[model samples]
Target: MRATRLNLMRAFAALVIVTLLAGCGFKLRGSNGSYRMPFHTIFLGVPDTSALGTELKRNLRAADDVVVLDKAEGADVQLVVISETRGRQILSLNNLGRVREYLLTYTFNFRVMDAKGAELLPATEITLKRSMEFNEQEVLAKEAEANLLYRDMQSDLVQQILRRLAAMKAPAPQASVPAK
Candidate 1:
């Protein structure tokens, strides 16, 4: 009887906490990366093999079943990726002139526009960089670590994109001028 009472109390407490959080308008957008976009239909111009693209697509699906159009003809917004670049540079050298630290960079440029090409979100560039210490003794391990860091950056970029979409305002309706 005591154990049952304890379990019931715990459940009640959890329910109260969830209700309070909801009342406070606190939403946790983590892991699932769900967002509320201003537009309903969107066309994303990205390849299937792209990690960021895949993550973005998943998030969009979670966002109220947003329409992912293959063509931009009927989309409310068309996302265009201008460029994606990855680079590495030597940051420091050891006493023997060997590399000690390296900087890895990821740059992404994108824009959102209507089917007629009016800009919704102008061209925005997001760049991420991480400094890695290298050791000749652990070449394979260091390579793996670099790959992990890059993957982490890709995930961050996806979340950033989602936040931007969530914050975007709906496009203003165009008014036609009467012919002279």
Candidate 2:
């Protein structure tokens, strides 16, 4: 009886913890794409062939009731990619002078503008970084690992941008012109 009671208590504790987390709006990274983009139609400035552009489109597709267009024509808003830059620096060196660690950084600058060219979001920058240890014997593996870290940072950047878009109030309705 005591063992059963202890198990029940543990389960109840876990349930309470989950509830609290939900109430506080805590979510796992990239687990949920529940944000709704304010714009009904959006045109991404980045080229479709780019990896970052592809991921951004994929995530934006999950936004409720939003249309992502292949062409800028007929789009209600445009998302401009100001710039994207990556950097790597030696974080540390081994006793023998080989690279022991590297600091990886991905910087993204972007903004949102309406069809009328009014800024919904001024230029904003989000930088993500990850530090990884290097192994001389695993050059190939380390390169692959570094690529993975960069991808992870890209995903993070997308999420942050999505959140910002969702937080903004929907753009003021544009006045429609009467047919001539």
Best by TM-score: 2
User: How many clashes in each candidate?
Assistant: 0, 0
Q: What lDDT would candidate 2 get against the real structure? A: 0.88
Q: Which residue runs of candidate 2 sit more than 4 Å off their true CA positions? A: 1-31
Kindly provide the TM-score of model 1 when superposed on the true structure, using C-alpha atoms: 0.78
Taking the tens digit of each residue's C-alpha lDDT, what string does model 1 give over 1-180?
Answer: 999999999999999999999899886655455777888889999987988888888878879858888887778888999999888999999999999999999999999997678888999999999999999999999999999999999988888998888788886554556999
**lDDT top scorer:** 1
RMSD to truth, every model? 5.9, 3.8
Q: What is the lDDT of residue 102 in candidate 2?
A: 99
Off by over 4 Å in 1: 1-32, 172-180
* Candidate 1 Cα lDDT to native: 0.88
- In candidate 2, what are the lDDT values of residues 1-180, reduced to their tens digit? 999999999999999999999999897864666786677888999976788889888888877888889877678888899999999999999899999999999999999888788898899999898999999899999999999999999888888888898887677777788999
